[model samples]
Target: MKSCREATRLMSESQERRLQLREQASLKLHLAMCAPCRNFGKQLSILRGISKSYAEGGPERTED
Candidate 1:
């Protein structure tokens, strides 16, 4: 089984490049059994989306 460190590394690297089939399978298996890692992955995706939106000038902020 892949360790949390390895799984997190894979998840992060996935953001920069495509993972191999074996890597994907291993990550999937690890995520399925690890709640914290799965949550971290979800949060990572959310942060990536937010970053991309800001980079793209997705919205303007207004002061309340």
Candidate 2:
């Protein structure tokens, strides 16, 4: 079993690149029992959506 720290690192890395099969399997197994990591994964998805929208010109930022 992977510790939450390792699992979370793998989870973050997965966002940028594909994880190995064993690593994916381990992350899946850990997330199956870990609520916090699962929530983190959801948050990552939300962030990705928001970022995509921003990249596509959904909004503009201005200096205060």
Candidate 3:
């Protein structure tokens, strides 16, 4: 069995557009069986939602 950190790393490093269906299924399977990794995924999702909300409402900062 993979460590929680290893599974979480694979989940995070995976590309949304590039991920195969099997890869996604595997990640879900791992998360379902691993409490720590599941918690990590949940927190990551929450943080992503917050960041997206902030970016949509906050002033735009261009780096040009």
By TM-score, who's the top model here?
A: 1
Q: Global lDDT of each model? A: 0.97, 0.94, 0.76
Tens-digit per-residue lDDT, 3-54, candidate 3: 7777777767762445678767777788778888888887878887788889
Location of the lowest summed lDDT over 10 successive residues in candidate 2: 54-63
Of candidates 3 and 1, the better by lDDT? 1
Candidate 1 residues 11-49, lDDT tens each?
999999999999999999999999999999999999999
Per-residue lDDT of 38 in model 1: 95
lDDT of 3 at 53: 82
Candidate 2 Cα errors over 4 Å, as ranges? 59-64
Number of clashes recorded per candidate: 0, 0, 0
Could you give candidate 2's per-residue lDDT for residues 1-64 as a string of tens digits? 8999999999889989999999999999999999999999999889999999989997778989
| TM-score versus the correct structure, for each prediction | 0.89, 0.86, 0.66
| TM-score of predicted structure 2 | 0.86
Give me the displacement of residue 55 in model 3, in angstroms.
Answer: 0.4
Worst 10 contiguous positions by lDDT, candidate 3: 11-20
Query: What is the C-alpha local distance difference test score of candidate 2?
Result: 0.94
- Pairs of colliding residues, candidate 1: none
